[model samples]
Target chain A: MSALLEVEGLVKHYHVRGGGGLFGAPVVLKAVDGVSFAIPAGRTLGLVGESGCGKSTTARLVLGTLARDDGQVMFDGEPVGSVRDARWRSQRRAMQMVYQDPLSALDRRLTVGKQVMEPALVHGLGAAAERHEKALSIMDAVGLSSRFFDRYPHELSGGQRQRVVLARALILSPKLLVCDEPISALDVSIQAQVINLLVDLQEKFSLTYLFISHDLKVVRQVAHEVAVMYLGRVVERGDPEALFHAPAHPYTQALVGAIPTPRTRGRARAALQGDPPSPINTPPGCSFHPRCPRAEARCRSEAPLLRPLDDGRFAACHFPVLSTPAREAA
Target chain B: MTVPLIELKDLTVDFPVGGNWVRALHGVSLTIRRGEALGLVGESGSGKSVTWLAATKLLPAKARIDGEVLLDGKPIQGLTRDQMAGVRGKRVALIFQDPTSSLNPVHRVGTQIAESVRLHRGFDAAAARAEAKRLLDRVHIPSAARRLDDYPHELSGGTNQRVMIAMALAGEPDLLVADEPTTALDVTIQAQILDLLAEMRRETGMALVLISHDLGIVADITDRVAVMYAGRIVEEAPVDALFDDPRHPYTQGLLAALPDVAGPRRRLTAIPGQVPNPAALPPGCAFAPRCPAAISGCVTAIPSLDAVAADRRTACFRAGHATPWEIAA
Candidate 1:
């Protein structure tokens, strides 16, 4: 199947005052640098990374909410140059974004029904009565009962508020959904509820998702393909099932190993040393070298470009974890 | 052979809300041995945090704490204010989730640590400063002396957390209560903090009460775990048994709901509803509505914690097959 959304060479840099030696020249923080990915129709591309790793920036760039410094975006074979184009307005009807905090994202003044129906009304897709019907249907699809239609944002539970958010996004009948840390604010059981809902909604709506989250477990469960980002760059990309088992990049290995799972009970996990360095002062060669355990003089001087390996996966690491089972077990 | 480091016997806490006593904890009993790590797992309003806050007398003035709090087998509930205060700060230190808020933004982190050291250790300024640097170094903060002069804002979340741990250590507390300590941090940063906590516990031999909602995280470090619902302990077991063969339906439900990163992909079986409002909890079991194995008796009668398998206790009628509390019609 043809890819529904395609992004190539996406870059977004923010200029901030200070950090320039002697002169007060601005420091350009590369929020997203040279990122590329494609999501096939009815598929999900999970972007997993910690804070300041540019996953959210990449998501916004993919959705065209934030202007990209340099990139190309193609939706259904049509190039999207700028959001200013009149055609982009109509194109936005096929795309939507679900933010992390459902409560803050919503207006307390508006009722759930009106909030869900606002997208349909804004697009001028139907009359007031038709919009009402669509909102009810969408709310029902997201597991929100009609009783919540007139309820304020505060009256609803965290999971219920998120369902309302999903209902609002789905009301637009968007083909592509960019969900950024959508369930991170929720509790465990409630997070599972939202995860199951997302899965069911995908199967029912045949939706394409660019799921951006730091939750590796949820990402592995919901995403067909996973991309591990480090300091504004994609370090590894591959299928979740195999990739998680035998992570190719040392960074990916650290990430996978660092995850607190009951399966690896007796094994000693050498956690990644420190937090990701500030994006503004990203390291000279590989940005992850400062925290990587296997860093060498070569890693300090030359950055390894993300390239394919014999294992049918890609990693931006010179000394990668061998994918072969024999080598990995030893 | 001696008494546990701390113990809570039939503890209950109630706050006067609208002239009526609204219960926060319903008869919680737990023991923390010296150098042992205990995990308290529950959602918000589950009384896991309250159990510690009440034990430490950190709850608000109006919170009515009933039952016995033991320190070295002596009932501390009857202790005088000055005695309890000394026992609280010098022996049992508390760390919160947001260290930034707990820390003074204006003061240098070094000064904060030194202050804690001086207060707990009764050290002079120069000695306190030296001890502060040593504590920082013990927490694995690189260049501890240099980072001491930096303000809380100057440090990363991970680094700020290390400082918090250092300050908590300055007390040389016998038992440290950490409430959702790593929840606010990023995953990789959280891993670093968790590693530091584990290493520090090994070095200090201090009892650690880790209050968190993350089951995987709790399972990773704690030797034993207590699962709480509404305002009571639903189950208590060794960490391995709790994860492997959870008996309580609520515990089983929680495990089934988790998404496994390294395992096969399966549809998550989420519990049907949200946690009940503590103010208007249903009669009998607070978790009956959410429990998959709830029975008719579970609707009206509360279940008391009963011993189940060896080293395990569950407050469920189904798990232990023990009779629940008798009630009037």
Candidate 2:
């Protein structure tokens, strides 16, 4: 199957005033630097990273909400150069995004039903009666009752509000959905409900998803493939089951080991130390060298490029774990 | 058992909303032995936090608390405000989830720590500053003395949480209550904080009451665990037993709902409905509507917590029968 979305060499930087003086140079913070990935049609690509790891920035760039400093984004075999282009406007109808906070994403003044139907109205897809019917059907699919149609956002619970958000996003019948921490704000039981809904919706609609989240468990459940990001770069990418079970990169190993599992109690594992270094002054060579447990002198001078392994996985590490003997012998 | 360090007997808290009172806690009873780590696991509005807040007399004046709270075998429920203040920092220290908001933003983190030391330990200004540095060092903050002078904003969330731990440690209290202490932290940072808390408990032999919604976290840290649903704890057992064979339907559902990292991909057994509203809880067992194993009798009568084994207690109508595990198999 052809890829639904392809991002190449995506870069976004922010300039801020330095501490020198009035004539001081501005510091360039590379929020997303040289990141590239692709999501096949009807599949999910999970992006897992820490808080400042630029996963959200990549989402914004893909959605054209934030202008990229440099890169090419190909959607449906068409290169998107500018957001203002007529093609970009029409392409947006095939892409929709769900945010982390449902309340903030929704307007309190508008009723839940109207909010869900607004997308259809904006795209001028149908008349008022048709839009209303579409909204009700979508809401029903997301497990929201018709009674919630006239209720304000505050009247609904957190789970109900999120269903409304999902209903709104799905109302557009977008082929690609960019969900950013969609269930992080929910309770455990409710989080499971939403995750199950996303899975069922994906199967029913054959949707493509670029799921960005910090929760490893939820990501493992929904993602066909996973990408581990560190300081605005994809350090590793592979099948979720393979990547999680036998992580190649040291960073990926640490992340997989750090998740608190109920089965393992009092089992000790090496944890990555210290907070991520400031994005404003990313370290030389590998940006993750400061916290990498197996950093060598070579890692400090030469940056490691992401290379494919024999198992069809990619990792950017000078000495990746579990390498084949032939490569090590070389 | 040598008079438990802290014991809460049938504690209930009610808050007025609109015209009627909402029962936030429906007679919660728990006991923490000296140096024991008891995990309280529950969803939002499940009374895990309220149980501690009411026990410590930290709730707002509008809240009406009933039942008994004993600290060191002494009644703490009837204590006056002045007397309760003495019990707060000196005997029991409470740490919240968000350390950034809990710490005073304007003051240097050192000054905040020093103030707590001075208030609880009766130390002089110079002594308090020295003790603050020591406490920061104890929590593994790098360059403890230098970080003491930095404001809250200057530190990362993990570091700010360390400062909160430092302040909580300033009192050298016998019991530490940490409510979702690592919820806002990154997974790696969360591991660091959990390790620090475990180390502190080991060193000080201080009893810990860890309240969190994450079952995995609770299993990793606590010796015993309590599963709370609605406004009451449905099950209580040693952490291993609770994870291995959960008796209550809610507890079983919660464990089954979690997506496993090591296991094969499968559909999650999500609980059907949301948590019941505290203000208008249904009669009898509040969890009946969502309980897969609920019976007709469960809808008319509340199940009291009954001992199922040596140290396990479950509040289910069919606790002794084959549980959800057997049913699923």
Candidate 3:
């Protein structure tokens, strides 16, 4: 299958005045620097990272909510432009975003049905009757009943509110969905419900997803392929099973080992020490070296580029946990 | 067994909301033995935190609390505000999910820890400061002495949590209640915090009450586990037993809902529907509305917690014959 979305060398930086008096030279904070990836049609690519690791920024950049400093984002074989551009406005009908908090994403004053119908109305897809019909059908698809149609967002439960958000995102019949921590704010049971809903919806709609989350377990369940990001860089990318079972990057290994598994009781696993360095003044060489357990002297001064392995995985590491020759053979 | 360190019997807490009462806790009974770690697992609004708050007399004045709270077989329910204050930090230390907000951001971390040490240990400034440094060192904060001078904001979330641990330890309390302590941290940082807590518990022999929504976390840290739903604990058992043979339908559904990292991927059997509002809870079992194994009779009468096996309790009409458990078997 061909790639539905292709991102190349995406870079986004913020400028803040500091280091001197009132009007000092601005320091550039590279929120997302030289990030690149692609998502095939009707597949999910999970982005796993810590809070300050630019996952959300990448989502915004893809959705055209935030302009990129450099790089290209091509969707459906067409170049995506600024949000205000006429072509981009029309192109946005095929893309939609779902955030971590549904309450914040939804408007309090409007009923869920109205909010869901608003997208269809804004895009001028159909008549009023047709829009209402489309909204209710989409709501039913997401498991929201008719009783909740007129209820405001506050009246709904967290899981129900999330369903309303999903209904709104699907009302326009978008082909690509950018979900940023879509289930993080929910209870474990409710999170599972939403995740299952997403999976069901993906199958029914044949949707492509850029799933960004910090929960590796949930990501593993949903994503066919996974990318591990650290300080505005994709350190590792591969199939979820292989990447999780035998992670090549030290950072990925630490992340996979850190998850508290119920089956492994009192198992001793290496935990990464220290906090991720500030993106404002990221480390000289590898950003993960400060917290990496197997940091060599060479890792301190030289940045490793993401290199491809024989197993169709990519990792940016000088000394991978797995031997290079064996991994290549596999 | 030698008068458990802390025991709560038939504890009920209610709060007034717009002239109506919200039943936050419904006759919660639990025991924490000395040097034992008990995990309380539940969703939000499940009264897991309220149970601890009411046990420690930390609830607001508007809350009407009824039931017995005993500390070493001594009644502590009717204690005066000052008396409760005396029991709070010196005997039982409580750490919240967000350490940054719990700490005084403006004050130096060392001074904050020293203040607690002085209040509980009756030490002078110099002695308290010395003891505070020792506590920080115990939590494994790097450059302990220098870090003592840093403010809460200067330190990372993991470091701030470490400082919170140090402050909690300054009182040298016999029992420590950590409520979602690592929820706000990163995965790797969460592991470090969990390991540190385990190490500290081993060294001091302090009884621990770990409250979290993550089953994996609770399973890893606690010796026993309690599953709460809608202000009531539906199941209680040894950690291994609970994970291996959960009798309650709610517990079984929860365990099955969790996606295993090392297992085959399949559709999660998520429990349907949301938790009922406390004010408008159904007459019978709170989980009946969402329980897959719920029978018709489950809607009319509340199921009291019954002993299902040795050291295991379950509150479900179909405890042994639940469909989910049968599938697991």
Candidate 4:
């Protein structure tokens, strides 16, 4: 299977002024230190992590909207070029990103139909009438009615607005769609409606998704493969079912357990302790060691590398959980 | 038996819209016992927050409220502003979703907490400040002494919420109304805050009302759960009972809507259509338009919240074996 998109050793660093004013001190913020992932054609890759764990940064890097300090991003067997390159602009139509906030993503002044056609209009794909026809057809595909064609963003509900966003992204018929917390802003019932729509659209359009969300449940449902990131690094990557059933990395275990499921009261104690450390001054050795339940003496000074387990899953932990017999061989 | 710590009887609220009144809460009746952990689950504009806001008389003066709010079986609805002030923060502290915006940014975290202490406890500046430090420590904010002088912006979101909880605790209220308190924090931090709230409840024996849209959190934490929709509570039951056997169609739909984190994967059974506009609500049950179990009578007559069992109550007319329960009632 050929990967529609492949990212390796992605790193983006930012220089920030430490706590105090101008002359206080210069600090390095490694927003996305080193991340790697690949999404096969028509399959989804879920990126799960806490805020400031560089999930969003990784999304932008994959799309080339943000310049990377060092890395390689390959899309459809070709290395993606810098933002200034002509090839980058040409390839932009093949990749689309759906943002978290639908209200902010759409322009309030424009009609929903106008907004849907904006991407095609910007790319100079067709005549005005052709774009209009294309926009209405795309709207129908995303479950939006013709009555909403003239309606402004404010006129629509959160779910409808999200459909507009999805319609706009799909108008160009991109191979890879990057959705970052797409349903987080919606209500629960509305969230279900959108999720179901996403699934239907994925099948109909044969779209490959790089789905980024902090919600483990939603991710588990939508993604075939999942990557668990902590402090700008991938801690574990494997099949969502296998990985979530019993996580190898301690951080992954803690994250999976932390979600408040609806069935029953989980363990009395919180699986993980404390909060994620500041990305600017991340802890030495393993970034998760401070909050890790199975931290040892060596974990304090030596960072772990992401290596494949016996079941084809990768985990960046020295003492990965040995719940499965096959894992001992790793 | 001792009277419940707080009770709201037939509470109703309406806000005047462009020419008509939009009813936000419709005859909400609920009670909270001493040291009870109650969960209020609902979608946006579902009246979960409005129930408390109206009960506490925190809604704006323009909004009309009709209800009886009782504290220890004593009607507090007729209390004067000065008396009501005592009920609000001193007797029932409130924390909102966004801790950063809820707090006064210019004020130091400690100063805000100390002011709350001074207002509620009538403590001197020194005593209030000292108590503020202790409260912060209780909420598990690290380096409590150093964080005292830091502005709300200087602290992380999780730390600021800890300060808010500390400030809420300054009143030492019998009931703490946390409205989506951990919604803004990260998953790990959310866990920490939930653990903190649970620990505090165990230690202090204070009742808590957790208002959130997240069913998972509500199911995990609360002893009892109330599921609301379109300004009405469609179902109320013991936490386990509600999860085990939901009666209302809306309640069932909500549970079905949630994608499972573990176990088998299944297609989501999302409810059809959007929540009806509150101002132009249907003459019948507000949920009938989207309910799959809706019957012919559902369009013509409203369903009152009827007792389904000794411990469970539902507003749906077709709530499992509704005919038998109707005769029993």
Candidate 5:
């Protein structure tokens, strides 16, 4: 199957001020150092990580919101050099993004109907009457009431506002959606509802997703394949089923372990020490070596490339967790 | 042998909305023994925060709080503003979700900790400063004496959280209410913060009321667990019993809704619909709209918390049994 979206050798760096010597030097924070992945047509790739891990940066790069320093972003076998490309404008309709904070994403002054129909108008889909009808249909599809059309962003609840955002994204009928922690801002009770709506819509529309989120549990629910990123790099990538069952990278293992389980109580977890190292002046070789529990001499000097294991899972690690009968028995 | 360190009986907190009272909490009762950790697990708008705030008499004037909230067998409901202020940190300390926001940006970390000690314990400048340094050390903030002068923004997220914990511990309160304390920190840091709370709980024997949405964290640290849906406690039991065999349909749905890391790749079953608005709750059961095991009787009859098993209580029409999703085919 042909890949819907392909990103390779992606790099993004932010110019951060201060913190060098007596006089602060301009430090370049390497947000997305060298990340690469692909999302197949009609499938979801879950990018899982902690806060400040460059998952957001990578998403911005894919969405063309943030420019990459050097890389290739191929969409439907065509290279996307810049958003300025007239062809890219047409392709924009095939791609849409759902932000984390729906309130911030929406224009509070505009009504819910206007917000949903604006995308359609921007794309020059149809006439005013047709656009209004299309917006209402999309709202109904996402489980929003028609009564919400005339209401402003502030008038609706968190869940209702998020549904409006989904309606907007779906108005374009995009083949791929870049959902950056879309449900994180919601309450738990509402989170499930929004997730279910997304699932139902995905099946209905045959959509592909680049779902970026900090919550591993939610990511597990929505994603078919999983990619674990650490310090602006894809540390591990594999099938969600295999990755969760037998995480390869130590970071992935720690992340998987850190998740609160319902079955057990106070199981001794091997917690990592200290915050992640500064991305501006990262250590030589493995960026995670400083906090990695199994860090050895080789890990310090030699950066391990993401290598595919025997089971087709890829992990960048000097010492991946040994998968034995005992480990799998859990 | 003695009364629980902190007890809340028949507590109800109501907020004035558009001229009428919106009941946030309804006749909730709970107790926490000294040194024991009680986990209050619920989704958003479940009144977990409001329950603690009202119990501590920390609610604003607009919020109407009724029922008994006692600390060391003394009623705290009708205390004067000054008396309530005196009781707040000295008897019951609160640690909020975002540590950075809680800390004063302009003031140094040491000054904040020292101020709490000075105000509550009436310590002098030097004594309070020394006590602040010691409190920081207790919470595992390295180089406690030096970091005292550091501003809140100067410290890392984890270090700032330590400052929050240090401030909460300075008064040496008998009961600590940590509301989503680890939600802001990274997962590894979250684990560490939880460990720090456990360590402090062991040492001080201070009763803890941990309010969080994360079931895994609650299950890890707490002894007893209370599951809240809308504004009512649907189920309350020992942590193991609740996780092993959840009685309430909402509780069962919540557990099943969680994407199990160890389970097979299956569709996660979510409880339908969002949490009903606090101002406009359903007449009978607040959770009836979302309950998968909801019956016709559930719509009109509000289920009181009844004992379904040994030492377990559930507020559901079908108690003492599993929901359809939980039952094995």
Candidate 6:
């Protein structure tokens, strides 16, 4: 499958305030610094990171909602800077997004059926009767009853509202779906239902996905491949099973270890000493060196670029872990 | 092993909404032993938070509470407002979910913690500040004294949570009620905070009543677990047994819906309905509408928690013989 969406050397920076007044020195926070990735058709690539690591910014950039300081976002083998171009406009129907908070994403004044039909109407897909029929079908597909067609947002539960939001996104039948923490705001039982629905929808439609979330467990369950982001860079990328079982980078190692598992009790963990450094005025070398457990002298001055390993995994650390032994291999 | 730290019998809390009363808790009874962590697991609007809040006398003015809240077998129901205030800060401390909103934005974190200490313990300003720093140090906040001077806005979310925990501990309360304490934090910080809570529980022997929506989190630190649905405890059991063999239909549904942390790709089984609204709850078992094993009989009557096994309680009519546990592979 050819790449449906490719983000090449993407860079996004925000000019933030310093301690002093307007005359004080200006500070730049590199929210998404040279982050690169690609999503092929019918595949799910999970972007996993803590909050403030620029994962959301990268999503915004891919969705063309944010202006990049420097970089390229190629949609359908074409750049995406000026979306008004006919090529971009035609390809726009091929992409859609499902936001995390359905309460904020949906318009309260509109009915569920109207919300789902908006995309169909925007693309001039069909007539009013046909669009209404399609909206009801979409709602049913997402597990929303037809009774909710006239209900407002306040009348529905969080799960039902999210399903309405999902129905709206799927109405266009986009090839690529950008899900930004779509299940985080949901209850656990509801979360499982939504995730299962997404999986089923993906299988039915053969949709590619850029799944952005901070939940490692959820990512492991759904993602075909995974990318670990830190301080606005992809620190590691590999198959979900391999990376989660025995992560390569120390930061990944710390992250996987820090997760509280129900199977075991009170396992020892290498607690990160301090919080991540400020995005503004990042360290000279590795942006993570300040909080890295295995930082060396060279790490202080040299940033490591992502390099492919023997097993087709990519890691951006000078000292990647030795290959997992037979016993530890998942 | 001896007298439980906190006990509630026939606890009921009702909120006045327009003119009618919305029952948040319905005749719920529970106990927390000293140094024990009791996990209260439920979906949203399940009344897990309301139960504990009423036990600690922290409910808002609109709530009318009825029950016997026994702290070491001492009834605190009829205590005056001043006496209840004394019970709230000194005897039972609360650590809220959102640390950002819980702490005052303008005050220094140390001063906020010191204020709690001063309000309950009556320490002088200097001594309270010193105690506040010590509490922060105990919660593993680095450079506690210097960091205490920083305002809430200047601290990170995780640090602010640590400061909240420090404030909760400043009064040396016998019971700590942490309501979704780590929900707003990242996973790494969440792990650190859980570790801190575990360590504090061991050292101080303070009974902890933890309210959260995550089953895995409650399973990690809690000794026993209570599953709440709509406003009642549907199932209560030892941690291992609850996971190994959940009896109630709702409990089984929750377990089946949870993604197995260690497994290949599989479709999760989900219960097919939304949680019933608290305002207009169903007449019978609240979970009957969503329970997979719900029979015709279940919809006609509310089930009381019955002893299914040693120290295990389940409220479903078809609990033990009706619902069989399935471990996700």
Question: lDDT tens digits, residues A1-330, model 4?
Answer: 879899999999999998777976999998999999899999999999999999999999998988999989999998886666878877888999999999999999999999999999999999999999999999999999999999999989899999999999999988889999999999998998899898889999999999999998899888989999898999999998788887899888778777887753544544576778889999889988988878998888999999999989999999998584211111
Write one digit per residue (lDDT tens) for candidate 6, span B230-280. 989989998888887888878788877777445455677777778888898
lDDT of each: 0.88, 0.90, 0.90, 0.89, 0.86, 0.85
lDDT string for model 4 (B187-245, tens) is: 87888889889888998899999999999889877899999998998999999999878
Q: How accurate locally is residue B38 in candidate 1, as Cα lDDT from 0 to 100?
A: 97
Report the CAPRI category for model 4.
medium
Stretches of candidate 4 above 4 Å error?
Answer: A324-330, B321-329
Q: i-RMS values of the candidates, in order?
A: 2.9, 5.5, 3.7, 4.5, 1.9, 2.5
Q: For candidate 2, give the lDDT.
A: 0.90
After the best TM-score superposition of candidate 3, give how far the Cα of residue B31 lies from its true spot, in angstroms. Answer: 0.4
lDDT of 1 by residue, B45-95 (tens): 899999998998889999999999888888887778888878875889889
The residue pairs found clashing in candidate 2 are none
Residue by residue across B1-329, what tens digits does model 5's lDDT show? 79878788889989999999999999888878888889999988898999998887778989998899887888876789999888888888999999999999999999999999999999999999999999999988878999999999889888899899899998889888999999888887898888889889999988889999989899989999999888788899999999988888888888767765766655666666778888888878998887767779888989998887777788988775556765521
- DockQ, candidate no. 6: 0.55
For each predicted model, how many residue pairs clash, with residues at least 3 apart or on different chains? 1, 0, 0, 0, 0, 0
Q: TM-score of chain A for each candidate?
A: 0.94, 0.95, 0.95, 0.96, 0.95, 0.95
Pick the DockQ winner: 5
Q: Candidate 3 at residue B32, lDDT?
A: 94
Off by over 4 Å in 3: A17-25, A323-330, B325-329
Against the true two-chain complex, what DockQ does each candidate achieve? 0.53, 0.55, 0.57, 0.52, 0.59, 0.55
Question: Comparing to the true complex, what docking class would candidate 2 get?
Answer: medium
True contacts kept of 6: 0.50
Off by over 4 Å in 6: A21-23, A324-330, B322-329
For model 5, the interface Cα RMSD in angstroms equals 1.9
